[model samples]
Target: MTAMSLGPAYSRLWTATALSNLGDGIRSAALPLLAASMSTDPVIVAGVAVAGQLPWLLLGLIAGALVDRFDQRRLVVLVDCGRTALLAALTVAVLTGSATVAWIYAIAFACGVGETLRDTATATLLPPLVNDADLERANGRLVNAEVAGNELIGPPVGGYLFGVAMVLPIAINGGTLALAAALIFSLPSVFAPAPTSESKGRIWSETMAGLRWLVRSRRMFTLSLLSGTFAFVDSMWFVVLVLFVQQILELPAAIYGLLVGIGAVGGLIGGFLAARIVRLLGPAPTLTTCLLAAAAGQLMLGLASEVVLAALGLAATSAAFGVWIVVARTQRQRSTPRDLLGRVTSASTTVVMTASPLGALVGGLIGREYGLRAAILLGVPALVIAACLAYAVLRERREPAP
Candidate 1:
């Protein structure tokens, strides 16, 4: 399906998502820099990261249940508006010189709560705007926007703005979110699920209902587990990537930043091309190729001593990740019941959230003891295994839509 065929409602959704993610990326970069400036204590600095992630673990299911129960368009608009308010307060604190490490942590956690709700609601809202056959295309466009805004443009802009004036990035983030809220509020009405007796069940049970459905669907469960593994390995490898660039590759810090930008560019390309690749190779083979490419990329990073080689490795891995995201999300949306989309998406996110920190800790330890290269090398086997599983389980025969 063509992009225009997806309709104007989807365009508004896309614009809102891109704007919100740009704000997210700006805050992500600025917050840590702000934290480190406030306190030299490592624990205090780390607390900001932990606080931002805590909501995903604590509220993912609850947010999903709420999305399933409510009007999704209004839910996302409210969440974004709430986030804008929080950021506006934060911007004021920074400008007034009243901001503390504790203040930053609180706002981070609260904004994270808003993120959980907005993201889950947006995911569930998409199906009504596009046909199932066009999900891959639609999802690819969204992923492209996310990669461009979050990785490519937002961080550099945030870092630059922070250097000029600490309050600038924060204020800009607030403005972007406020605009995003307005855009989301303007989306046309979507198909609301007919209320069933089951829809009125308690939140906990409704959340569990999503898990039960995921567990019963063998294909989805397997795919989600693989996705979790990918998230784990990716997070773990990234923790040591800085050290690898500095120590093994002997590249300057500027080179390291350049490599990250290169990787982000690769992700943009990958997301843009994903739908076409899927059409050419079929979904199973495309996913399998991406996994294998990720494995190869990690191997290259582990072995390379030169900046050129290392950059290539990082870009390859990032591109593979980008493609995998579009393919996986499209499959999930197509296979699941509409009523369960929010919950299933959140359940998958919970797995990723739970795995990432553990992976980061493990990577830090292993890299410190064994070597940075070894830490990256260890991720290769996991990706290879995931690739093998994707090929075996996601074959064309068994993947027909329900």
Candidate 2:
């Protein structure tokens, strides 16, 4: 919330995430809109999203282990460079008049692979860069940059840029990613990841080592499980909301960018306050509140008969998630062993996000079969119940559950 510097290195890392996520916002908005033009079918549009998230399922563990076994700084830089190249290629495809839905899907998946690798390494890098006491605050600042850059400014900019020309946003995305890599390159490598004692085998076996560690930790495992349920529901909400915005709420393309931008404003607020809230309420209550807020937001979105109601609901939902990310990631960072941080973070991310593809598919089906409102309305109770369960789990002072 304050301008208190997080030191020069963290400043660079924070800037990199913020700058890259701005491009992320542009790409996410533009890609879906581009897909919509290529095909009106919700399923095809949904598939692009599925492709984007599929790497978490397919490569999360392998990537995590590789991150742990290699130089984290280089891993992040290489991934950024790869993402930059992929965006450049996508821009060319669009300009040459040869872009297709299939090309979008392929490019999205490739970029996602790069993202998964970068995120694991980045998560591992933080603990070394900052003291334990500052983890939550640092996480908040990082997230604030992400929410503002990606959501608040990026989406709106992307939507307007697309109106100027399809190539406009794509060109900018590539440039931004290149900038991010350069910023990251400015940060020194904290240290090389020390190989695990039993790290003398194939990567899959090495990968499962992290999952096994996660499953063995009752607190981490339970929290991840609870979060996954909401993530699944949230993905469904996301898909249906696009249709809800255009078909039901009747917002046009540019305004859809504004709608996402509004939500990001809420996210920025939440991210700014995450550290203070977590300190005041403690981790359990902070997480419990996030779940309840998310449920309320979803209900508002489902029941809204007007644009303002839906927009407010979306803003609330995004704010809740922004708060949730700060609290949950800090807790994990504090609790996990430093040696296993990359693997554990990756494993948890994989578990929580693994539901998104399914959510995309199911949300599309529910929208097509039952209608968009039904798709959204169906998940409200599940979310609330998950909140209750998360609270109960976090509050348990007794021995950890097996």
Candidate 3:
């Protein structure tokens, strides 16, 4: 595929996503650590994590439906503004010595809600902004930006800022969101109005149509299943990794950041190469192989005792995850009609992400009872099971009719 030049409007959207993602990355790392600092209860800290993800499970579909009807660019701006205010409030509360675990949980839940809106709109808007032939490359660029923002820049900076003062990271995160909001406001309208007939339904009926369409599509159904499974297993690892690094390995916070940052480098590489890899391997087979490789990497993590070895395993796992996401996203964009894209993507995301909170709950229990190492090991089997499910359910499928 030839390189497709995006217009100013599309470029602005991409810039906003990249910038906001960086803030999101910082918050993802800092928020949990803040929760941990607030309470000695493992379950409470884990609950904070759950709060952040639970909105995606419950409100994702509704958010998607709204995205389908509303102006996506304006919706994005609204969500970003909401996030900015929420984070700013949290920062102020922390600075004034008024913060508690409950406060953190509330803030997290609010952020999650805003994120669900922003993400659903962003996913649906991409296809309309760029040419059809440029989908893979555009997706690759977005993925690359996300990895750079989330993995490389956000976590490490958050870690250091947390070390200095928890309020600093929160304040910076809010500022980032504010900047993203400003950028979003400048984005030109990317979504065309939905067809008149399609827009003339009750909200519930529209939502059900989206859900039905998604479930009826063989490719989408398989992809959603695979994503949900992957998220479940990954959430398990995420919940345990911090404890393992801090308690078992006895590493400093900065060192933990370094390890995570290094692993994210693999994600960066994977994102950069996603389009090329998809072309070379074909989308379905390449995605399936990546899932298996992710399982293998998790197995290696389960067996690793040394920090360097564990980091390597984490890097490999991240790489596989990154590639799989890009391929899956490209396929979804290619197969789904633009009009139904928002609701369908939201429906699929909600179903798949439902496993995340459950996984986090299980991971916390296992980590507290058996140990963090064992909890990490639990992800190995989950990953393998997910791989098997993908191969059996998705690999033989043909593209769904649009």
Candidate 4:
């Protein structure tokens, strides 16, 4: 399906996603740079990163339950506005030279709360806006926008802005988030999630319901595990990646952003091709391929001795990640009941995101003690296990009972 065929609502959502993600990319790159400059301690730097994701582990389930009860569109708008305000405050802190590692950590944690809420609400909000049949294509387009803004354009711009002034990227990030909030607020109220019986349940019960649903479904549960594994490895690799590029690869900080942007090129290509690949090869085989490809990419990255080879490895890994996300998310959306989408998405996200901080901590310690390359190499084994799981679980076609 063409982009236009997805309707104006999806387009608006897509645009807003891109805008916010652009800001996300900027902040993501800048935060690490800021932390690294302040202290060369890998664990300290990783702590800054870890704080941002900790909310996912702490508040993820509660946020999901809340999303199911509220107006999802409004929730997203409010969350974006909150994030904008948070960044604006951070900008001020940075400008006044009052920003300490602890201050940055607090702000990152608050923003991550917004991220958790906004993500759950958006996943629940999308189904009403697009046709079920176009779910994969629509998801792919959204992924495309996310990669373009967060990875391709955001990183390089953030890196440049950081060199100009530390506060510039943070300030600009707030502005982009503000714009994203406005866009989301503009959408019609028809975008609201339909109320269901679960809405009346207690928060704890409602949260449990989502977990129960996921556990009952072998496919979703398996996929969630695989996703969590991938998240762990990805987080580990990225936490130490800045150090790798600077110390091991002998590249400047500016070039690090460029390398991430190059990796995004692969993400963009994968996002555009995901739906088509799923159509051509079917979801199972396609997912299997993505897993194996990611494993290969990680292996290449771990073993690379030069910038050119490292870039290729990053690109290949990103491509696999992009496609895997679209396919897996599309499948989840398709399999899930509409009323439970928010909670289910939250449960899944919580599971996946919980791995991130743990991975970050491990990566930091390992990178500090062993080597940056050793930290990256850790992902190779995880990906290989994930690939094996994918093949075993997803390869067979189960015919429906007549």
Each candidate's TM vs. the true structure? 0.94, 0.84, 0.82, 0.83
Candidate 1 residue 158 Cα shift, in angstroms, is 1.7
Which candidate tops TM-score? 1
lDDT for model 4, please: 0.83
Ranking by TM-score: 1, 2, 4, 3
- As a TM-score, model 2 comes out at 0.84
lDDT of candidates 1 onward, in order: 0.86, 0.83, 0.80, 0.83
- Cand. 3 Cα-lDDT: 0.80
lDDT of 2 at 220: 84
lDDT per residue as tens, model 1, 1-402: 434568888887888889989988888888988999988999988888789879999999788888888888888888888888888898889888999888899989998999888888888878888777778889988888787777888888889999998989999999999888888888777745657679475899999998999888878888888888888898888988888888888878888888888888878778888989999999889989999999999999889988878888998999898899999888888888888899999998788888888889899999999989889999999899899998988874564443
Q: Provide the lowest-lDDT 10-residue window in model 1.
A: 393-402
Local lDDT at 368 for model 3: 92
Worst 10 residues of 2 by lDDT: 393-402
Per-residue error for 87 in candidate 1, Å, reads: 1.9
Clashing pairs in 3: none
156 Cα displacement, candidate 4 (Å): 3.9
Model 4 root-mean-square deviation: 4.0
Counted clashes in each candidate structure = 0, 0, 0, 0
Write the number of the candidate with greater TM-score, choosing between 2 and 4.
2
Q: Which residue pairs show collisions in model 2?
A: none
- Name the regions of candidate 1 deviating beyond 4 angstroms: 1-5, 199-201, 399-402
Model 2 CA lDDT for position 392: 79
